[model samples]
Target: MQYSQLGRTGATVSRLVLGTMNFGPHTAEDDAFAIMDRALEQGVTFFDTANVYGGKEHRGWTEEIVGRWLARSGRREEIVLATKVFGEMGPGRNDRGLSALNIRRAVDASLRRLQTDHIDLYQMHHVDRSAPWDEIWQAMEVLVAQGKISYVGSSNFAGWHIAQASEAARARHGLGLVSEQSLYNLLSRHVELEVLPAAEHYGLGVIPWSPLAGGKLGGRSEKGVRRQNANTRFDSEGLNDQLGKWEEFCSERDLTPGQAALAWLLHRPGVLGPIIGPRTMEQLDSAIDAVDISLSDEDLAALDEIFPGPGGPAPEAYAW
Candidate 1:
């Protein structure tokens, strides 16, 4: 696996990060543990997870599972751990958001679950319009001083929001966001017009989620049609039963859909890493292998013809 600096921080992460969104819901605990082991064995040093993914019954045990994997494997130092906050956790009104009170309470809870004193990268999962920038930055800087988190990042934020937060941090708290994470895939190119350029301009490492447009770019297709009936989750948002428009690009180039899709984003400027969460080990292997598939200028030009711009026509599915 290739490694690169996680934004301006000294820490380095694998170009392809092992995402644990499906760990508790889609994958059993044993299987999740095995996935982590296999990924680490394959030189995947970066792991991404969120607090709410394990189901409330486990009380954040998804993070606990990763903690156990580190303990059992004795390879904590070998990996760069990344996780997120700011998702609804319980009935309480304060259970979510970027407010200082919640950020403090959440980090303590995360640390206890992860069995670690310091988090390598702590991320805000969503923007909290309720909290002022000063409040959020103050909490984050406190965590840094307390050794609870090393660096901070933002996810699912727009370019303007990122700029506002950065300006607040630098002008007031003297602590700034080091990276930005957003959805970026062959089917979803919305981030290219603003978010990508903003990250490059501000030196924020860009971590792309759903690099394959969920599984749309990786699934089987024939005659430019994809069988969306295979997964219930795939059947929603007017995207059901449609093959992604990028299929035409892949067919012309004789490349696998997933390869063409991933290769395209890998070439996008300022992308520090791509998050890949596969249900099965075989699927994971295919995602990892995409790094080796190179797309030439002609290939890119042809692909562009299928989905030409930031406001291009929608793809077969929007999940990825």
Candidate 2:
């Protein structure tokens, strides 16, 4: 596994970050533990999760499992742990958003649940449009000062919002966010509009989630016996969206759409890490295969011809 510095931060993380969104809901405890073990064995050191990922749970069981694994395996020091807050966690109105009180409460809860004294990278899951950047940044800055978190970051945040936070941090001389997590994939290149440029300009690392467009590029649905593979998240509703034009693109090139899609992301500049969720070893192998793929200029030209960007480096409001 190749490691890279996480943005301007000195911490080095693996290029492939293991995503724990599937841990408690879609994957069982034993399987999830095995996956983590294999991932660490293969040199993947980054693990990304959120407090609200498992159904409607306030604190997902995934973190608890991971905390236990860290204790049992005695490998906590070897990993770079990342988690997010700012999602709806319960019935109360205060259960969500980036309010200072909630930020304090959430990080404390996350630390307790993870069995850790500090979080390596604590991120706001989304930009709270109602809250000012100062409020959120101050809270995150407080966490860092209190030694509860090693670093701060934002996810699903736009360029303007990130800029505002950075400006706030600069004015206060506080630790600003060093990374931005957003959806980036061959099927969803929306981040190229503003987020990517902002990251580059601001010296922030871009750790993209959904690198495979939720398995649309996993190569499982390709024609022939591969289509029948059960290792994929191939439900009828999702499969409906996966068919037609996209399939035609894959067919014409004689490439599995999944491999082609991931290869495209790996080829992209300024991609710090990609969070890949694989349920089984075979699926994990397929995702790792992306590491070896090198797309040709001809391949990139064809992709550009298929899906054109919004053009040049300018901050545009994206749907993501």
lDDT of 1 by residue, 230-275 (tens): 4343345645323445665667668777766777877877998788
**RMSD (CA, Å), each prediction:** 4.8, 4.4
Encode model 2's per-residue lDDT on 42-103: one tens digit a residue. 88899998988777653567777787778788888899899999987767788799999888
Prediction 1 global C-alpha lDDT: 0.79
Q: RMSD in Å for candidate 2, one decimal? A: 4.4
Residue 320, model 1, lDDT: 36
**CA lDDT of 1 in candidate 2?**
71
Instruction: Give the alpha-carbon lDDT of every model.
Output: 0.79, 0.79
Candidate 1 Cα outliers beyond 4 Å, as residue runs: 56-59, 221-245, 248-254, 311-320
RMSD of 1: 4.8
Query: Candidate 2 — number of clashing residue pairs?
Result: 1
